[model samples]
Target: MKINSTVLLTLILLILMLGAGSLSAFLGFTLGSSALKGVSTPDGRPTTKFASNKATNAQQAGLTLLKEEEILKIVKARIEGKTKAAKSEKLDEDDEETKSSKQKPEEKPQEVVEEKLQPGFPVTAENQGVTLSVQSVRYSGGDLLLKVKMQNKGADSVRFLYSFLDVTDDKGRTLSASTEGLPAELPTNGPAFSGTVSIPTALLDDVNKISLSLTDYPAQKLKLDVSNIPVARVAGLL
Candidate 1:
């Protein structure tokens, strides 16, 4: 018997659809079983090997991430520690500098000492019975010292006292020494009289000269120019 063409076509389509579905199901089962076998252990038993591998991989990744985070934390802490130490050190240095800047310095006092004059000339004066001489001029502090020698060369004793001691400048301003302030005293019949005469350095200058005039000897008033002396130099007295 001859079949209708449309019905025959419909039957062929249904068979093809059924065969395609069966083939797809067979392929899916085969692939799924093959994957399962690849992940299984040697024993023919159900296994979670694939799942265990996936979990292990994920755990290893987590550990790596955790280690990296710990390293970052350590590095950050070190950097912060160094920064803090640097800041603290700078602060200490600044404090020390400030203290040094605020502190005051100590003061020292000036002391004056004595010094002798040099390159002096000898000046001599003689009378009928007494003779006087000045050999050197010395200096100490603010005073000038004169080294004088005297002698009684006559048959009788004679007393010698301070006569006139004066310093003169170009302006003729005179500063004289008094008898009460004289540094030496001559006795009667004294063979030799040796002493000093202190004159204020303020009363004289480098350009000034001193003149010792004795207008009064033992008991008589007689003017005599004993000494007219200049300073050691034109600049300083000694």
Candidate 2:
């Protein structure tokens, strides 16, 4: 009975040892193959929580970069639009100014024209078959200019006596001229001549009539009268 009890005890101990070894091997294989849920790398160096935090941070950074780029593009477009609008406004203003300038009035095209004025009237004088015709008169630059046409129906050219042309107001006021020192300039063209005569503009003030007495020595005298002839203003100049 002692010998049989010892053999049975040894067999029981060997079976327990074999079962413990199989349980240890099964637990090791399960832990290695079925990994933890959030671990990222194959080496399993990062914890599951650490890997999740890293992924969240990378996503946030990428989103922030994209938003900044969108904002920059919007700002750039706005700036470009503003610049173009300013240029367009300036061009419109310039075009309007140019149009206004073009519509403004300008000076007359001709140098002079015939004007019937109230300060003086046409007059004529004849001496030795020579006739002097005064057409029109005007004032400019403190001087009086007269349009005079001269003709000789006779053989010889007639002369205009110096100191014979005189200006007088109705009040007997003798008007003086700043250009009184200038002598009469007669045309040398034979038989017919036409020109303008210049004198002092101040002489026509409140004047009624001007007289020119042409004489042939002590023989005869031809008298001409200019009355109420209008004086014209100068044009084309300031």
lDDT scores in order: 0.66, 0.61
Residue-by-residue lDDT tens digits, candidate 1, 25-107: 99999999988884855654346677777898988888634588899999999999999999999999999998987895665
Candidate 2's TM-score:
0.35
Scored by lDDT, model 1 comes in at 0.66
Q: Report the error of model 1 at residue 64, Å.
A: 99
- Candidate 2 vs. truth: CA RMSD? 22.7
Name the runs in model 2 displaced over 4 angstroms.
1-121, 177-189, 216-228, 232-238
- Which runs in model 1 stand beyond 4 Å of their true positions? 1-120, 163-171, 178-189, 221-223, 232-237
In model 2, how large is the Cα lDDT of residue 118?
37
Q: CA lDDT of 106 in candidate 2? A: 81
lDDT top scorer: 1
lDDT of model 1 at residue 143? 75
Model 1 Cα shift for residue 71 (angstroms): 99
